[model samples]
Structures are given as structure tokens and as C-alpha cells.
Target: MMLPARGGPEPCGGNHGSGRDHSPARAMREPTAMTASPQPPSPQPPPSANPAATPARAAPPIRIAIIGTGTIAHTQHVPVIRAHAGFELVAGVNPTPVPWWAEATGGLKLFSSMDSLIRSGMSVDAVAICTPPATHYALAAQGLAAGWHVMLEKPPTPILSQAMDLHRLACAAGRTLMTSWHAACAPAIDPARQILASGGVRGMRVTWRENVRKWHPGADWFWKPGGHGVFDAGINALSIACAVMGEPLFVTGATLDIPAGAATPCTAQVRWATPSLPDGMEGIFDWTHRGIEVWDIAWTLGNGRRLLLSQGGGGLSLDGVAVTLRGTHEYECVYSRFERLVHDGASDIDYRPVALVEDILSAGQRRPADPSFRILP
Candidate 1:
């Protein structure tokens, strides 16, 4: 499959030139004390003799505990949390010894388990669960029950029922429970959404192919039943697509390519329908390409305008011209929104993407894995 061209230079990070304009606008000239002869100053109300009131103190940053110091926790979650002013990384929970980088970056107070972390009397207002998909439910549920706001990494749980249960737990505890669909917050997503909303979509296609060995390396969990195989990363594309063209109403058909002796599919082809799209509009997700990585989604509008979002939303082109989007700092954006969700006492848990994954798993036809294909060590 041909990947859509990214069309321009790589999106840069950091808010280098961005800063609030704090300088006051030019002061308006004091109106010339013209005619009106300042009517005899109306008697001014007498000032209270009590001491002046003090300003309210600012709330302290939300202390966050990082659960599972794995690849994502190290690469994205931890750095973003450390840089964001609204949050503080106070501790880390993982069975493995705390990674060197985690220790170097202020030596997070480490614990082998969630129970131990909670029992340690460490102050934490929220928890960022970065563990594998199968473990998300248990950890998130425990956090919510312990009165901590929870931010779960993508594919919130292995199945839809568990995700819904977490939502209920969060609601009962009156805490924020957010499923971080990082791709949904990409730079180009909002623009694509607006384009689709205004100009009806005729069709949509997604190509989310990448070499598992390159990205996941020796991760054995990926071949397990709940590991989600290709959909593990493909779901990011699905989430972005859903954000652009409303949620898929149903999975029309699907095919799973599972390796021999493996419980999960290494590659999957899924077709889904959405009322927002025209009748017979087919959306394709292909995750088996080997050479170059392709992470893109394209849409055909009713008026023949072709829109493409590629590089997992780092680049966008509408009818061939590069569409300028805000800087691409998806993880940063995720944490920023998470902070607001925590303060507002509201939850933003959307199960549409995961529900779609579950649908495919339940209905897709399974094929034997290629005999020559070797599982990455």
C-alpha cells in the first residue's frame, strides 16, 4: 500500500516563540476633564475599618503516581508529566527495578505494587496507568476505589465491559477517569473533524501498518489473547478516524491473521459503518505492511475534496496543499486536558474506539499465521 505523502517539514516541538502577552495594551488617554464640572462628588461610601482580605491561595499541583515504568511510561508519560506544571510525578509502581532513567530523573519513590504504594502513605492525587492493556482494569479500579483520579493509557482495558465498569467506578467515587487516546488529540485531528463536519464525507481509508519488531521488540505480551496484536497500535488510527468521522456504528466484516500457536492476530483487516458517512462508505484498516511504516487516514468529501492526515497526525494535506496545524505535542496535550479534567471533577471516558476493537475480535474470521513468519524475540 502506498502511504500518503507527509507533504512538508517535520512538525517541531516545544513552545519556543509562544508566550502570553502580559504587557498591558497602550493605556487610553485620560479623558480631558471636560465640561460637566464634576458634579459635587457624591458622598463616597465609608470604607470598612476591618483588615483587608487576603487573596485565595493557589491549589498545589496534582501529585501523580506513574504505574508501570515500561516503554510508554518512560518515553511519553513521565516526560510529559514532569514538564507539565499542573502535575507532579511523586512515585512509580512496577515489579521491575526502577529503570535507570526513572531514577536519574529525580529518583521516583518506587514500589513493587499498587497496594504497597498506597500503604506507604505517599501522597498522590492521581494515577497514570501505563501498563499493558490486560492490566489496565485492575490497576485503574484500584486507584479509583482508593480515591485517586485515574488516567489510563490507550485501549483502556482488554474488553468493553471492563471499560464500562471503570467508568461506573469513577462515577461512584466522584473522581476523574480518562482514557488517553493520544492520537485523538493530534494537531490535525480538530481540523479534520471540522472539515468532515462541514463537508460530508463520502468515504474513509486508514493504513496503520508498521513492523512490530521495530517498535515492540521482544514484547511477548503482544502475542497473547488480550494483547490486541495489530489493533494495539492500529486502534490509535481508529481513534483518530472516529474523532474525524463520527464513531463507527458497527463492524461490517473483519479478518484476523494470527500466527501459528499465537492467541492474538498479528494483522487484521476490519470494515466498519457509520451513519455519519454515506451509505456503502467503507473504512479499511490494514496493519501488515513490512518495509516502510504507514500511519495515515484519508477522506473523500462529497464535493471531491481529498483530505489526508498522515504521520499519525503530524502532517496534514487538504486537496494536496499542506494544511497548517498547531504544533504536534500529543502527549503534552493529553496531560493538559487531564489536568483540567481532574480540577473540574468530571470524567471523559469514551469507549467507542475500544468497543470497535472488541467488535472486531468477536466477529472477525481467524486465519492461520504464515508458516515462514517468525515471531520477534
Candidate 2:
């Protein structure tokens, strides 16, 4: 199968340009004053994908809205937006009412739906969508239609075609559509990529095991059809693998251990086909491991050297020596790139990781496992 374009958010080690706009007026303008309405005018023919045709003038402290205000939004995105100097956390849109904690302390203007948020005429330059995998396409399309840059949570969407459509929509709208593959944002990834570039990969293996009950607690959606199950965490490793290899990776074969009643798998072993390592790069994902969560990827180079990324790519080691890596936290790194993309008027929607997941799930062999999960309401 042909790989999709690979131009998503750049690795954290690259230069994102000097964000040097000190425009006081753009900074001081409130969200309501940024745009008159959230509606786009009558659709013209899809515009050319050239961002330079009309240079984007988005100034720093970008007015951004959060779409879902769920677990990721509250813990990762909200804090990052509040802490980042280049973003202004304007408001949030959720179908359910805001929680008491958010209502009391977030100082966030919450709307029950996108239409409600639109009716309020609040303006924003971008939106970070932290909703479930299934809702991503519609919400992101809405964000693009409203003339806002979009940041989708990992997997982008459960379906590949939906993600492709969103990419086209973003390109035609001349807006940034970023996939929030935060695992690729780890500080050690770029260094690992640089080291891997020095030699060919002889072999690669990924072992990602965690107790889904312990990590996910009450997230019932995890076992549903659209909920990626084990691949939800497995794809993080793949993202890092793709980033470190500096190329796309394809799945050759896969074996899925699905629970008896669950729609998704609980464990998966996927074999990857790559040029350098034809019969190599195996990834094992299991959500039923009891002790010591393991998330690591090890590689044997053509030269006599070994590289390892442990703790979900947070730590790196080479030849029994720990290579010191430095950078901002992963989510912060993610927002920094979004800030740059918005300023540059560009979209970064890498399709390889999602494609890998879709392929593995769609084509993998399936076996029944003990149904140890209870799907919550």
C-alpha cells in the first residue's frame, strides 16, 4: 500500500521559526472581537493549498478554544494552554455541562455544544479537540469551517477516510490541522532519530504492556468499536518509532487477542515490514499486564550498537550509556508546534501512525481472550 504524505508536526528538535510578532492590538483583542461570527461564507471552490497566497497574520497569544473539556483537555491541554505564553485559553465546548471543578476554577466560558458556542459569536484562532476518536471528524470539520486551526487527539479519527477528508478540508480552508500525537513530542525522540540516521536498523522490537483497568479506570469507551483498545497505547510506541526512524512503517502481519464480549482487542502482536529490516520490528501490546508497566522500544543498528527508548520514549539509552536529553514536556512541545503552525498558516496531519493502527485492526488475525473487562455506562 502507498503511504500517505508525511508532513505533520516536525520533530521537537527542529527550529519552528522565530515567533516575533509583538502586536499589542492582536494580543489585547478579546475572543468575541476576533471574528464577528463562527460561520464561513458561501463555499467557493476549494482554494489552492498554498498558505503563502494569503499570508496568515495570527499574532502571538493565539485565542484558542478547547472542544471536549474531557480528561485530556483538563489534565494535558488546559494546563498547557494556560502555561504557554503563546496561547490564550478562551473557552470550551462540551455537550455535557461543565463539571463543578471547571465551573468553579477554570474561569472558562463553557457552551453545551458547538452550535451554542457559535450562536454566542465567540471567536478563536484555533481549537484543540480532546473528544473520543469517533467524534473527531465532525468536530474538526466544524472547527475548520469556522475558520479555526484544529488539533485532534491521537488517532485523529477511527476511520482513515474521515481523517483524509479532514485533511482536504483543512488544506482548502488554508488552516492548520494538527494530529496530537504527543508521544512523538518526547524529548529523546529527535536525538534517537539523529542516532538512527547514522546507521541502518538491523532489528527493532516494541514491548508495551499496561493494566488497562489501572490506567483507564472507568473509561468504558475503551472497549467499544471505535475505541482502539490495546492499540490506543500501542500507537504511541509506533509514533515514536516512526519519528525515530524518520520514515513510515507498515504492518505485515498481526495477531489480536480480543476479549470475549469486547469489540476491540486486549492484546496485539504486530509485525512491521520495512526496507532495512524485512523480517524485523515486532510490537507487542497488552492491556492485561499486572505489574510494572512496560513501554519500551529497542533497536539493533547495522553497526555494533544498541538503542533503547524506555518509559514511553521519555528516556533514551545507547550502548549501556544513558544519553541525557533536554526539552519541554511533551504536551508543551505539542502546543509550541501548534503555535508555529498557526503562525505559519500550515497543517501538519501525519497519517502513518493512524494508518498503521487501522491496518493492523482491520487485517489482523483474531482469537478470543478471557473477558476481564466490564464496559461501563
Candidate 3:
């Protein structure tokens, strides 16, 4: 939504950005009580309506395929698709077996790769990309040009130009292209937005730090150039910031901590703008913390009743006031939204948030870590 244009990763094409594509094997395995579309899907909306949000349509299950079976896919994508009724889990192509959740599903088809799948002659309405950031551009572009709708994992592309290209393509194709940020659906976000929406004016503080070894032990994808390190965690905060303040928070001053011996930042202390926002914000983030570190949000309300959020916006307390959460239903909600988009023949692939991440990277200065980082057990 914000910048230049480009093509898919392999060669490039479509609205501007890279897309993923491939084909199918058997006929789409339609779930009971749903219509088999000749086409795709998107995320779902609430069963009931709020005056602020649009009423969502309950769609028949959408015909779908998945590319790149990685950790995120095993943990989220594959599992969510099978468990939810809004989709027809048609194809799974990863150069390997359907990891855990996908394996649980009885009889879905598999492909060697997107290119292989498409060449095989099976039909699919949409493709879900769960690959790392590095490959997103190409994979996504292929999918879009092939007339398939796309649903991407977070921080769609490393560069703004690529993200812009994808956004433009989706608009032109009149197909759905959603770069979903799963964390936004966290329970604390809704009420947090409500508090800000009520119109209180004030300044804020934010901190997000986690033990990298605990989260990414052997997987060293962090410092890999485009593999945006801390912001990987910070995107959740960014998603919340936009939901609360309404637009991209202008980055004022930032110094990212690259491990002295590595490339990406392990921590960052920065200043951000909330101009015209009734509530403003500032923050600090780190991934080198030793033990369980903090992931929190705080604000000074107009009345001075400071509101705070921890557990990454799950447990909230206002001036020491605590709010209990029920459960997280994000995956189900994601499929539900997909169902609505497909039934309505619409796509929601916006690059605003991804663009913002790109902007932060492009604008921010890089600073190396103190002692530098090395492997640990």
C-alpha cells in the first residue's frame, strides 16, 4: 500500500510484488455442508456485528493449498486449515511430509513444490505461504499471476518495493491477497483499542524482550539480512500500535543492536511518533535477555490511571487493575475470515503493515551488539 512495485521472487510479475503458485492432484476435498468453489479464501469475521466493523459472510469451505512447510506452518497454518471448516485442505507441497497437524488430516494431496504442483495439472483456488521472509517475494508473486488468491504469514516481504508490488497486483487481479499478522487477534488487543478509542490523550511506554535461545535455539534465521530480528517480535507490538493509534507510527530515532559478530539486531531502543493521536507511544525491545523477559505496554490516561498490558497484551491491569483473558481463537478466526473473502469473491492482501516494517528497517540506523553473540546450549 505504500511504495514501489516489483514481481514474484523467481522472475517477477503481477501487481508488482512476488507471489507463490503451483497446482493440485485430486479434486478439492470438499468439507460437508460447504460449497466447492471453482476458487479461493480469506480470514473470517465475527458471527455478530459491531457498528465499527462490517458484517461478515459465512462462506462455504474454500479450496486451498499450502507451500513451504516450516515451523510456523507446522504450528499454525497446517493445523488451522484442517481444524476449521471454512476450507478445503486440497494440497500440501513442501519437499517433505505434512509435518504434524497436516499429517493428522487423513487424505490431503502433496506436491514437491509450487512449480511442480502447478505443472502436475491439479486445480486449486488459493495458496497459503508459510515460508521464511527471504522466499516470500518470489513465491507470492507466482501464486498471484497464476490466478490463485494468497494468504501470507507475517511481515510479508523484507523490502517495501516488493510489498508494494504484491499489494498492487492483488488490487489489479481482483483476487484476495492477505498478509496476516496472527498476533493482532490476541485478546488484549480488542480492549486495548477500545481504551484508546474512548478518546484519552497521553504518552506511553513499551518494552518487548525475550530469551532468544529459548525461542530460536538452533534456528539461526534471525540475522539473515532480510530476516528482521527483533521486529519479528516487535511486529506484534506494531500491529497493536496501529490498531490503537490508527496509522503507522512515524519512526523518529532508532538504533538497532546487531550482534557485534553478526548482522541483525538483538535489541533496540527507539523513539516513535504518535502525532495527533489521543495517546502516544515510545519503546524498547531486545532478544538477548537471559531468562523470561518482559513483553508489555503501558499508558498514562488523561485521568492518570495508568493502564498496563503484559503477556504481550493478554493480561491487562489499569492502575493495578487486572483483566483476565478467556482463550485464544486466532487460528479458527483466520480460517473464518478466509471463508468470507472467498464466498464474496474479495481479497484483503494489504501491505501497509509489512510496508511499515520495511520503512523502519530502511530508515533506522544499525548499531552492533556489545560483546557480540555466539552459540550456546
Candidate 4:
């Protein structure tokens, strides 16, 4: 059975600014695992009188652009990109004109389409695609083909093949392709992973519940085909689970509660095949729960102790006692990792979570349920 709600989602912590700073000191806060607290920025030395005494200048920030200026872009991506010292917000691509985006991006040159952005001869080092899942493959492919690093929002693509194709393209192009699983970047994730890696994971359960109206409001795309519906939020749990487990997840069976006239399920109950546990791992994903949203995972160790990761991997507790954690700034960690990947000419591509969702959807049984989602026209 699913556990009771602990608390609602906690706001991520990071530096807040217009993202106009070019100094490395203004970069995202880097936090270590477990009790490793974040260190303060180093103090800059005084300027030397002799020209030769001055140190070499730091590398210029990566010029990046945002595609699809919608809610996610406005709220999460834009703010993070702007606040990141390693990136400079240079341009945006959206068919519809957003009057406020000009000021938000510091009067960046906005293009009506990706084609226009590419045709304009703009210098861009990376592109963050925050568009819908169905559009991810195409946008990411275009970005990679253009010789720019690509950062894709969760569920990189609706299917596994498309995601793999993008990975191949990125590899051939030698560009960094990051499938951004923000939940995996949460503070408690690494700590939880460390504990699980040490062994003794007897049993685990995932309960992910949320009031869709509160978080997505009138976002009708979530109910459409390829929208992923409840899996959109549920995938975060899967990502956290796979990351912390340090192993691939296999779905034994699933039961889906799809709403009437909707192309996707509003709730899902999935069972996983875990070799260690007799009952294995069970997951409950619901989009209709009211009050405080719950995104929690609980594990029972063989020693009779309990390990809980709550608030979508933002907090960790053992035996009901909370542990002090840092690096709760998910997007900051995401951008910081992206910076490293680009610098190292490497890619971070993990499709396990998406594969798990696909497996559940493929082998799950479906039944009609009452509709609570407000499908915007």
C-alpha cells in the first residue's frame, strides 16, 4: 500500500539573478554527496600593477538559446539558464510571439522557427529543447545536426527508438546530448544511491500522487497521445528509482486507469520484478490526489531499518529522522553537469526511465476511469 502524504514539493535552492554575469564565481553552486556541504566561492585576488602579473582570463560563457518558450521555459529553463554563469542566453525560437520574452532574455533575437534561427547565422553553442515530447526528437536532431550541444527535457522522446536515434546522431556529431532527468539531480538521490549500493535493499515502494490542476492547470497536451499523461510526473519516480538502484527496472505487469475520452491513463499501478525481494517493487502513480502532492519512495532494508526519499528526492530520512542535505538545486546541478559534458566532449544519455514507462504502457491492462483533467481547447 502507498504511504500517507509527507509534504508538498519543495522549491529548489540556487543563485537567483538575471544571468548577465560572466564571471565563474557566479556559476552554479556545486554540492557534494551526502553530508558534503557546498563550499563558498573563492575570493578574487587583487589586480597586479604589472601587465604580466595578471592571470589568464577564464573561458567565455557558452552562448545558448532556448526553444519553445512555454510554461516550462518561462518558469524553469529560462531562469536557470539566465542564472548560470557558464551560459549566456542569446536567442529563442517560438512560432508565437512572446512580448515579455524580449525583456526576459535581455532583448535576445527571437526567431519564429528553428529554421529562421539557423538561417540567421547566429553563434550558439547549445540549445535546450523544452518542447512537447512528440517534438523532442525532431528539435534535438536539428540541434545536434547544427553542431550544437543539446539538452532535452524529461522523456526525451515518446518511444525508445527515437531516443536511441538521437543518441546515435549526437555521438556521430561529437556533440553533447543530455537527457535532462531533473529529479535524478535532486540532493537526496546520490545519498540514497550510496546507501542502496552498499546492499541490503529488501523491499521498495513508490507512491507518486499530485493534483494535476494545481501543477499543470489547463495544459491539455498532457492528455493527448504522446503526452504521457500521468507518466509525465510518474517518470520522475522511475528515474529516481533507477538512479538510486543502480540497475535497470523490469516491469512484470501493470494496471492503468485511463480516463474517458483521454488518450492516456490518469493513474497507474505497476509491479516490478526484483530478484532480491519476494514482493518486488510496486509503484502507484495517480494524478487526481488532492491537497499536498506526494512524490515519495520507501525502502525496507534487511536490517529492519527504513529508508525514505520524499519530496521527489529532495529530502532523505532514515528511521523517521531527517538528514541535512545540500545540492537541492536540481536545475543548477543539471546545468552544471551539462557544462561538464560539453567541456569534456561527452554525453549523458540514460533511457532506462523512458524504457520502463514504455514497458508498463505496452504490457499494462487498461480500464476506463472518471475524468478529472481539464483539457484546454
Candidate 5:
């Protein structure tokens, strides 16, 4: 799940800023599987100025505009664009330009608004909407209609109807529209997907718990009706869920615990039924269990086989074997894939993932647990 207001380097919903999971070692892993059908072992990149900047492919990178120069924009998205050749770091938009340090991506023009950028002759080939979930629609629709390809950050938007409309418009315009499920782009997940596809799962149980107060601090926006707090991370699990299950799962039940006076759920316990697999398979997701947060996703197969995948969308500990990836690049990998699409046409929005989240939002309209979420001292 793409956590909201994750601005930069803040421990988001107990993710510890994802800084720990992605180590220098991650920078040393093998190339993604999609690059070559079955290439022979090749030399890896030695530590250089910026290994992450290495492009999956090289060319005149797409002139891309990153709308909303917020936290993730400066931290991950911009770096990915700069590191690769599939995209060019042409311009960015925000109330203010990214600071001098942010110029690492280089040759960036900061605009005050989308209209300003489009009118400035920046000639953007694509636009990555880095704005908050609530504002995604207005800006995305603007980009797509303007004839530039668009890549939207996760939770593509707070509204499903608007997202669906964006999808329609994208189709109508025949422009590449993508929603980056950053977790799904992890180069480390290839093995996990192999196991699931090999019929290793019979029944899977998933759990994600964390300490929000300490992590979020004064981020009061999370408790608002559309802030999408815990699910911000929870959706990462869902994307994995959709990847394994590979279809839209219907939400069977859910209990959202909201702060008493707040409009959004601080914690959520949800149940979803996956499409029939080898056996009748099902799963559960919990967004607010407190402490270091737990992401326990296990699969129980028939014939007495069981596999538990844990440690948050990172790796898989199959039956008992944990594959330690040399690298754990998420957004870098995502931007790599986007670069691929820009060079060769491709689309990567996981609707089934969003569909389930929408069901959860629609299913719960209850009172928040402590309402005092807003009155915090």
C-alpha cells in the first residue's frame, strides 16, 4: 500500500520509512527478469555515483512532468526518473520549486500549477501525478486530456467513480495511463510470485499491524474521511493479494475502528474471498494491530503443504526457505517499468487491487473509535 503524506523519510504507518528494507545490498542485486528472456549470468553494477540511476534502457528519455513536488516526489520518484534514461526529468510543479539539493535530477523547471507547466512549452511526453489521493482525479484527467501520458501514484485517487472515469478517458485517448503499485514493482518479488503461481497456496492468512501515533505525529490528515491511513500500507498487502489471487476478490466482511470524533478508520479488520483456486482459498487483512506492525501472509495448500510469507511485501519464506534478495528496489523498479512503457507501449494499473479497497470503503461507514484523533495534544 502506498502510504499517504509519506512526504519524505518519515516512519509511515510503522513502515520505518521503508529505509531499512532497502539497503545498499539492494543496490547490488541482479537486473529485473523482464529485461531478457533467459539471459546468462552477467556482471552487476559496482557501487557508482548512483546505481539506481542506471536505466533499464537508454534513449532520449521521455520529457516527463512530475506534478505535486511533495515528499515521495523528492525522495523516490524524481530520483528514479533521473537514474534512468527511459524518462527525462524535464519539469516539476508545486506551489514552490524543489530546493537546490533536489536539482540532482537536473534540468528541472518548477511550475506553480498544471496549467502553468503545460503552457510553458515544456513539451512533456508524460506526467506523474504525485499529488494527494483526493486531488489525483482533477490533475490526472487534465494530463490525459492534454494528450500526455500519465502515471498516477497509488490509491490513484480517493474516489472510485472518478478513477473509473479516468480509465475511460485514458482508453478513449489511447494514451498510456498507469497507476504505480510501487510494492508490486519490487525486483525481489519475482521468487514469491513463482511460488504462488506454482500452486503452493491452498489457504492464505494475512495480517499487517503498526503503531501509527508515534509514526504519524501531527499528521492529522490521516484521520479525515478520505485520508486512507492504515490502508495506505495495507494496500501493499492487497496488491500482493491480487497478484497471488490474480482477480478481484469480493469483500465478505469488515470492521473499521475509527476514532470517536473522526471520520476515517484508525484500524481495520477485513475479510475477502479470493476466486476459487486449487482449493477454496480465502484471506484476511488487518491494518491496525499496533507494535512494529505485522504483515503475516501465509498460504496453506492441500496435501499437507503450508507456506507463510511475511516481512511485508518484501520477501517470501516458503515452507521455510527465505530468499534474501541482493536488492530491494521498489520505486526505482517502478520507474524502470514506466520507462519501458514510454519506450514500448504498456499499462500497469491493478484494478482488482483498487476494487477491493473500494469495497472496504463502501462497506464501512461506522463511527471512528476515539474521535479524539483530531484533538490530540
Candidate 6:
């Protein structure tokens, strides 16, 4: 059984000035599994899979238009596309000129907007929307309506209703829509899921903290109303949590610590429950830290078996012994999956993460900002 949204359908209060309705809809239940936690040594997948062994495809390489040439697009999306055999980087859409790195790597046509790209007659089979969360729904809707497959960044949209709308739009347009959860595609995640599928879960503890200054730097949108504050990072953890424990019953309780001048929370503590585990199968989601960074999820099973995934799903341990797994290439995996989905005409739009966020927004309580926490810039 899945937990229901505590606060009926209502937008979680924040500084969402984008004019889009941020109201959440009813919670959607997903498949079940145990939560994540630390555990002892266990079996692991090979260091890496042979790319040659990937299912052979006779279709031509997918021509892709990359929207938003920001940090993530530059660091992960572009590089992966350049290396993948199944995709072609046909065009790039951004208001600013293409970045030096992107320009340096030749073979990309640039456009000022998605409209210009489409108007330019660029033959794009799919588009990867890497823009801010607030713009996702519009951009994705446009892409799907234009009959192009879409891969949206995490937290699919600002609100649960928008995400559902996109799913429905994609269905109507017969286009594939995938919401990318990079962390859940980590190498260690498969093994962790396998363990949970084989046993009963006791509880889970998630510690996902990072320095915004170090990662986001002067990205002001991060502190805006729809920016999702700490949730920008916290949602990744929540994605993995839901992947392991299934759809959350509801966000039992939460506390958001907003910075003085920021429109979003800088730190958050959230408790969620799922029906798959016992009443005591508690899960904690925390995102408030400075200096060193940490991303870990540990699960305790009913039989006392412990499992842990650290380094944001880059490392895995079972029964206290490290389990060496494949090198981390989450973006590459994402593209590979997209290739298959497009060829097979399938859509994988998981709304559990959006539902979880909506549940938190609807039911979680807001606390005063931490006096010491200051928003830079």
C-alpha cells in the first residue's frame, strides 16, 4: 500500500513566481522495494559491461537537439552524446552563444531558441531538456507536440500535475518521454535494488548534503521560488529512495530552513513512510551541510542484513565489505536507455519523485531560516 498525500491537492508554499501552477495532485503509488541503508559485503556486477555487447541496433543514430547548455549539459550530457554511437549531436539551443568547450568540440549547429532550431529545419529526432525546472513543462510540451522524443532533467516539472500532463501529452503525440534521475542510474543502484527485492526491509537512512557555493556557485535561480532550494539536490536522493522503497505513503513530517533573502529552503529534514515496510520502517531525507560533501543511503533489513550505497551510488558495500562495481557513467547509461526506448517506441516517465516532492510540499511544515546560513550573491 502507498501512503496518501497528507494535505489534499495544494501547491507547496514557496516563491514560485514563474506563473505556473505549482499545485500538486494526488499521490501516485509505484512498485515496492525495501529502503536503502548500510550493509555487509555482497555480490557485485562486473567492473563494466562491454559496449560491443550492448544489443545491436540497425536503426540510424538518433539526431538530438540539446536544450540548455549549462553546467550539467556541458559536463555530462554533451560529452556522453559525443561518445555514444546511438546518438548524433545535431543542434544546440541556448540564448547565449555556444560555450567555448561546446564550440571547440566541432560539429554542432547552434540556435537561439527551440523555435529557431525547429524553424531552421534541423532534423532532430529527440531533444534533451536541460533547462531550469520552471521551464521544463513548456519546453517538453513543445518538444512532444513537435513529435520529438524528450528526456527531461529530474523533478520533471515544478508540480505533479504538470508532470502528469506531460505524460499524457507524450502519449497523445506518440513520443517517448523520459525523466532522467541520474543518481538512480548509478552503477551501485542495481545491486542495491537486487538485495532489497530478495529480503524484508527494516528502515532507511539517507544523508545527502553538499555545498551550494561549491556546486552551484552564483546560480541565483537556485534560491528562487520554484528553484526548489535544497530540494534541487534533495530530490536526487528522494528519487533513489523511492526507487528502492517504492512509492512513499506520504511525507510524515518535514522542516525547511530557508535563508534570509532566499525564496527557497537552504536546508531540509523530511521523514517519509511506505506501506511495504513495517510501521517502524522509517526513512529520513536530509540536505543541509557545508565544507565536505556526503551522499549516502543505508538500509537495514529485517534479518539484520545491511546494505549501503555511498558516493552518490558510485560505491557499494554489503556486510561491511566494499563491493567493487562498474565505473560510474550514469549519463551514458541514460543515453543508452533512451536509445532503446526511442527505437522501441516506449515511454518511461516515473512520477513517483514528483509525487514525493508534492507530498512534502503539501504536508511538510516550514521553519524559520537558519540565522547563520547566508545566501551568497
Q: Give candidate 3 misplaced runs (Cα > 4 Å).
A: 1-59, 96-102, 277-280, 324-328, 375-377
Candidate 2: tens digits of C-alpha lDDT, residues 174-267: 8888886777776566668778878778888899998777666777676887778888878888777766784456789999887866888899
Candidate 1's C-alpha runs over 4 A off are 1-57, 102-104, 247-249, 276-288
TM-score of each: 0.82, 0.82, 0.79, 0.83, 0.77, 0.83
User: Candidate 6, residues 100-159: lDDT per residue as tens digits?
Assistant: 545634857778899998788768899999988888999999999888999998768877
User: Using alpha carbons, what is the TM-score of model 5?
Assistant: 0.77
Model 5, backbone clash pairs (residues 3+ apart or across chains), number: 20
Task: For model 4, name the residue pairs that clash.
Answer: 19-82
RMSD vs true structure, all candidates: 16.9, 11.3, 9.3, 11.5, 10.7, 8.6
**Which pairs in model 1 have colliding backbones?**
none
TM-score of 4: 0.83
Find the 10 residues in a row with the least total lDDT in model 1. Answer: 19-28
lDDT of 5 at 52: 46
lDDT value for model 2: 0.71
Worst 10 residues of 2 by lDDT: 33-42
- For model 6, the superposed segments whose C-alpha errors exceed 4 Å read 1-50, 101-104, 246-249, 276-288
TM-score of 6: 0.83
Candidate 3 structure quality by residue, lDDT tens digits, 1-377: 33334432532233222221110000111122221110011123222212233233365567788887766665566667766656778887787665553445566777878898788777788888887777788888888888888888777776677877777677677678876655554556556666755746477787887777766557766677777787777776766565454334667767877775556677877676665653356788878778666778787776777878676655677779786543344544455566666666765554455655666677778876777465344
lDDT of each: 0.70, 0.71, 0.63, 0.74, 0.62, 0.69
lDDT of 1 by residue, 1-377 (tens): 23336644422211111111110000111111111100010112112111222113266789999998877777677776776667788989989796555554586678999999999988899999999888999999999989999999988887887987887688788898887877776666667777877887777777777777766767878678777777888888867766666444477888888887678887777776776643444444443457877777888887989999887876789999998764435665577678777887867776777877778889999998666666664
Name the regions of candidate 2 deviating beyond 4 angstroms. Answer: 1-60, 100-106, 371-377
Clashes of 3: 35
